[model samples]
Target: MSEGLSAARQRDLLIATTASAVITDATLLPFFPKLFATAFGVEDPRHVGLYLAATCLTVMLALPVWARLERRWSTLQLLVVGQLGAGGLAIASHLTTELWSFWACTLTMIVFKASYLLVYPYVMRLVPKASHAGVIGLLTVIVHLGGILGATLGGWVLEHHDPRAAYLVMAAGDFLQMGVSVYLLRRGARAPSPEPAHEGVPEVVEASADDPAPALPPIPQRLSPLVRLGLLMAVVYFSAFITRPFFVEYWGTRSSLDGELVSGWVFAIPALASLVALGVQHMGWSRPGSLYKWLALIALGVAIQATPLPAAIVVGRFIYGWAAFRGLVDLDLALFEISPPERYAEDYSHMNLCQQGGVLIAFWIAGLAVNAGGLVQPLWIALGGFVVGAGVFAAYGSRFVAAAPSEGKAPEEVAPC
Candidate 1:
């Protein structure tokens, strides 16, 4: 291993890993649900719901395992293994004839997916503490841009070729990502580990040799006003996706336009919103006091989404996407400001669990709302959640400001829990 590689090399590796994950996600997302529905010969979208739910469930289940493995293996090793595993699974998913086999392959991919999800924390550890906002902003830009490209390419591939072909393309992307990871690892380019602030604190402590283990962080006990606020943010974060399953269902039942085309537009709304968010970050909206401004914008976005027109729906989605990005960035900054640095990884993992759990809950609630009311019910529910999320931040935003970083240190930064 080279003793002296530039910081740039390490960041480049992180970006490559991040970009690969985004590409892989984008490649699969557009058509996987439809593929499963077709393969199972199920007409109702809810059957496809199980496929999506399975991925999340598997990721949640594997969180502890990912954490444990990270202690034993390098981050690069984990990234390489995950990419190859997920890629191979993507290819295998195309070959499966039985629904059970499909489900099993999907679960296998989920194990890799969970590790891929850890890229954020892994990358955070690589960058200098003072550059947190900039590095995070750049990382978000790469992921979103990759998302845009992947979704666009995946949609195009699906339009011109078979769904299986689309999966093949995704598999190829995963392989390419794996190659990149292997190259970085072989070249001895790795992310910088977070340095300990005090002499007694070891930056990279191993699990105890004598003791067996302790219990996972209890979800209820981990819930604080801030964590609760994070849950609300999760609601808003996922509300954007709540209407996704129902897009085809609602369009087919109600609208005159082509269901597939409209669904594409619906997906594009978030992508467009992400672009606007990138712009906001460029405008320095990431700083303190900007949270309220973004929340107000989110409220406006919700109101726009509630309008009846299809164009309004698309516009509303774009606004919400932008708002969602800002909301998440601000909330993350707030969380870091208040959290102790050493406990950052645990806190972040807890918040991630909450966010994913919230998504699962939102999906269920949205389904019920649609069953009871109609297509528009989920929108209203999401709008309410965003309102509450914004309100919580506004109410307690002062607590965060009071805890801002001193002049010598970086802006109140929280380690990723």
Candidate 2:
């Protein structure tokens, strides 16, 4: 897959992907509710939740369409278009006074921003299978770091300057991403196509033929490997993200922390922990043999944070951050390793659609739970979701384990998971 690509181009593609990720993370992650509140004068928790859920829902709607577009366009071509659309929408949103218009522009922008979703599988296809874990780990680091930077930047703007200024910043990011994608697309045109294209979606079955399938639930066997993986991704994303929308609010109740900047840092504890994980994560002794341990630690972290103690909450974030990095890396590695190069974009889109579904539900539930009960309520729900997510992984994990890197054969030799 790496045959026609130069090393420099690979690095450039990664940089573009990282830029798109940081831009999206800066403007649209869970912390956006606070931004939305300040921007639109929205005070109700339900409104915040609904709007955030709407944002996520747009991504769900956009991914399948973008996935289908992959056949007609390169990922970079789509990114150029998406960034331009999103950037224009951001500016339009900034100009709007009415809440519904502002929301309409913002949500529409997300449908365009969703094109960045293609960056992951697009980059993965240019690299070798043996490098999957390392590539995924590094990308994971970029994502967490981007979250930390976004929170800090967004929080600072909210504290000292007009919160609406963040919209312009988002616009700047979208334009910058557009520029990078344009450069990459033009450069690639002068070079060979990254990989020989597949005619259509390849027929790759996930389960083994010789090994009898395990006693799984009533999920249809006809479901593609990517679709099955998507289901598992949905579960994990739901469990993990259930805590995100309400974290800043929850911190206010638990601690006297007054500044959005301070709260933002606290919100980014998991991202901070990602840096710590980077040091030891690549070490053989530190790596887990399976997904269960990481899943268990994530649950424990959520459980700890559910307590009212501020100190415990901080501690739990560290635990959750560390375990989440490992767990997500393994899960993503499983995803790309099994996916055929021909279907990288489409397969990842299917999986991410489910992942976004989980996040969308979590946003709604977290917001309403806080409105109905208290901030701590979402933590308990997240904890339960984590348990369910772990069970989902357990049932689906054998495919991942079978595809795991071994002494002689490449992980991709196993059927698509």
Candidate 3:
């Protein structure tokens, strides 16, 4: 089976890379309130939301810099640096005595952590285009699954230890990622490298008398389809996150749940649904048409969770679980449909910048709504915003596909040690 698994090593590395994407977020999810207490001397989760927004602000600021760095360095080299740097900063973050100090460390840490995003484009060079969807699907599954287990275990650590312990857990993941990257580099396996397609913005070609360059569309023309889809997906995620940081707080307010650990289960339910969707998707049940229905259902579920009724929140969350999974897969498929194989990292980074923007917006609103208004206000925002986003998604449905198909296939040969 190992011999038959062509590119199995690459596949393993991709999984490892994807694992880095979710572990910290999931591990840290259930401990936000505690972190707030440690940093700001408060028990309010609203502070957690604000801090999240701040971290994302740094992530947004760093995106272009990382994009440029990717052009200069190999993916493995960047991964090693990102992992070690983030791991060090993460550990340092735990030692902060005040909110400002913690924020400084965390923001720096995120800048390094963001390097994980480059791995997807690098791995695309190793597999067939027909396999891209499957690879992405499995990658998504790993993401949610990592979050699920991380949340569960995180809740446990919070029960027995301090919020700072969660940071330690995150640091461990960074170290592990660093170790994997080092192994890959030591093995001397290199991802297929692509030439620079374009720089910071879309470039206009200059035609010379000796060689007439073909006139091509500007960046906006090239990125519109994916950008529209990205905005829609961002809305959904942004809306959802508005309420996510406070799930444990909300559960305590609305239900008889004892602590954040118990409420973490509520958070994990949707991830559970994602796993189910992945299984069904794995069994050849995926369909592009499902995107529309999933969006509508997600909007509905968000509305339900936002209502005053506790039972509705539970039921709504279950539906949300299923819908979120399908929507995430659909959005990725949509991205894949339009993505240039040669420019996967560049293109996806742009899309991710959009997603991060959504997260930033949601977290800002979450901080505002929860801090100044009411606990349920973010849910209302989510309810309204998700519908608006999904509506746009459906409206754009008739036309969405890559301008051209990706010409990627199995590596003709890879650089080996």
The candidate that achieves the highest TM-score relative to the unseen native structure: 2
Candidate 1: residue 265 Cα off by (Å): 4.4
Kindly report which residue pairs in candidate 2 clash with one another: none
The clash count for each model shown is: 6, 0, 1
| Selected candidate, larger TM-score, 2 vs 3 | 2
- Model 3 gets an lDDT of 0.72
Q: Per-residue lDDT of 208-315 in model 2, one digit per residue for the tens?
A: 788886776655646555556667778789888878887888888899974788888888899889878988855645746568778888999999998888899999
| Candidate 3 per-residue C-alpha lDDT over 1-417 given as tens digits, one digit per residue, 9 for 90 to 100 | 133334568668768767765866578775677667754678765567777888777877676577678788888888899889998988998877777788888889999988877777677767766687787777777877887888888888778877777778888888888888887777776765443344453333434789963443323334356655666667767876787777777777888874667777777778777888777766888655556678778878877887767788888887887788777876776666566566666677777777788888888778778877777777788878877766654555534322333334221221110
Q: Estimated TM-score per prediction?
A: 0.81, 0.86, 0.85
Candidate 1 per-residue lDDT, tens place, 209-307, comes to 898744433234333444554555566556655665565445444446644444555665666677777877678775544676676677677677667
- Report how far off residue 298 is in candidate 1 (Å): 2.4
**Model 2 weakest 10-residue run by lDDT:** 407-416
Total colliding residue pairs, candidate 1: 6
